[model samples]
Target: MSGNIRSSLRGQRGMSYWSLIFYISGFALIILFASKLAPGYVDAMHVENGLKDLAEKGNIRDMNRGEIVRDLQTYFMLNNVRGEPTKSVQVIRGAEGMLVSIDYELRQPLIHNIDVVMKFNKQLNTAKPELCCEPLVDLEQYRKRD
Candidate 1:
């Protein structure tokens, strides 16, 4: 009776070889998907942050549509953003401020004949400055005085 009990315990010690292989394969697939998709998400975040930064500069309300597009292109270049330039940035003037919008897409190859595509849209409202006030002293002048 004791030998029979020990034999049963040994058989239940751990997962079977086939079960371990299945679990490892599933985890590998998840990691592969994440590695392929993470860069696109990161780039989208960078684009969003760049739009916010431009809005915070408090000059978008004064720039024309063309100027806004040029500014966005420059920002993308500065930040090393990767994607095709299909749609340009849109700048709409409003009663209280300007609305800047960026719409774009990214495509990456996953496996044979398979690709991952992502689309993103980011917008921001930049208010016009109420007053144009110069600093009390120029930085160059202040440095010379010091």
Candidate 2:
């Protein structure tokens, strides 16, 4: 009987009940936070792709500023993005080509007063259509800044 007990105890190799619960709860929190933040990233991608298409494919050479703004607003509508695009988007037409500035921030509530802010800052030229901006590259480390 004592030998049987010793064998059973040796065979039991796993986490304790409390330890398992702690790890499971921690993982659950991470997943919950990720689910909340993933949509913001998706919206940013839509905006970035829209900018790329506008700079590369759209005929902005002959279009006026109003036309450009209207087109961009329509794109936002199609992508289900909130707020006015004009608030964050700026268009400059020079002798060379059009210069577009896309700077926007997405805010999501995490705790009571604490919120997560995702900023997307990018500049694109119609003459040079390349996506160079990396979203949240500067905020890789989470720390309070003064």
Candidate 3:
């Protein structure tokens, strides 16, 4: 009976040292990933917010393409965002307003030979009178050919 009680207590023992190490290592890995990946996400959010603010200001509609690009550069500078402005920022004249868009990708190395790739594509419309650069597709054209 004494041997049986000792065996039951041993069987119900708490986590072993190895198990504690395994759990702690997993938590540490999660923290490492978050530390490496969070900044990129935060910067992307800043870019998105900056674009939205620009759209809300309705100044992009009044500016020419070059001026718009310059303004975007300034915004990026003020927001401490790092990216190729000429490639990322695009201004297109849509039917109802000016469309400003940013398309870019960020790559971050996590561990040995492992990496994270984040692609961000954000656009906003500034309501202003402008000639549509890309012609709107006529809805009638999509009608089923009889």
Q: How many clashing pairs per prediction, in order?
A: 0, 0, 0
**What lDDT is obtained when candidate 1 is compared to the true structure?**
0.68
Per-residue C-alpha lDDT of model 1 across residues 43-95, encoded as one tens digit per residue: 77777766766766755666787887787788878877766532546566668
lDDT of 3 at 109: 99
- Quote the positional error of residue 89 for candidate 1 in Å: 2.4
Clash count for candidate 1 is 0
Determine which window of 10 residues in candidate 2 has minimal summed lDDT: 134-143
lDDT of 2 by residue, 24-124 (tens): 99999899789989987777777777776677665767777787777877887888876633477766776777666667777889868888988777666
Which model, 1 or 2, shows the larger TM-score? 2
Candidate 2 residue pairs in backbone clash = none
Q: Give candidate 2 misplaced runs (Cα > 4 Å).
A: 1-13, 84-86, 131-146
* Highest lDDT scorer: 2
Q: Which 10-residue span in candidate 1 carries the lowest summed lDDT?
A: 129-138
Better of 1 and 3 by lDDT: 3
What TM-score would candidate 2 get against the native?
0.75
Kindly give the stretch of ten consecutive residues in candidate 3 with the minimal lDDT sum: 131-140
Superposed by TM-score, candidate 2 places the C-alpha of residue 121 at a distance from the truth, in angstroms, of 1.1
Residue pairs whose backbone atoms clash in candidate 1: none
Query: Candidates ranked by TM-score, best first?
Result: 2, 3, 1
Whole-model lDDT values for every prediction: 0.68, 0.71, 0.69
Higher lDDT: candidate 1 or 2?
Answer: 2
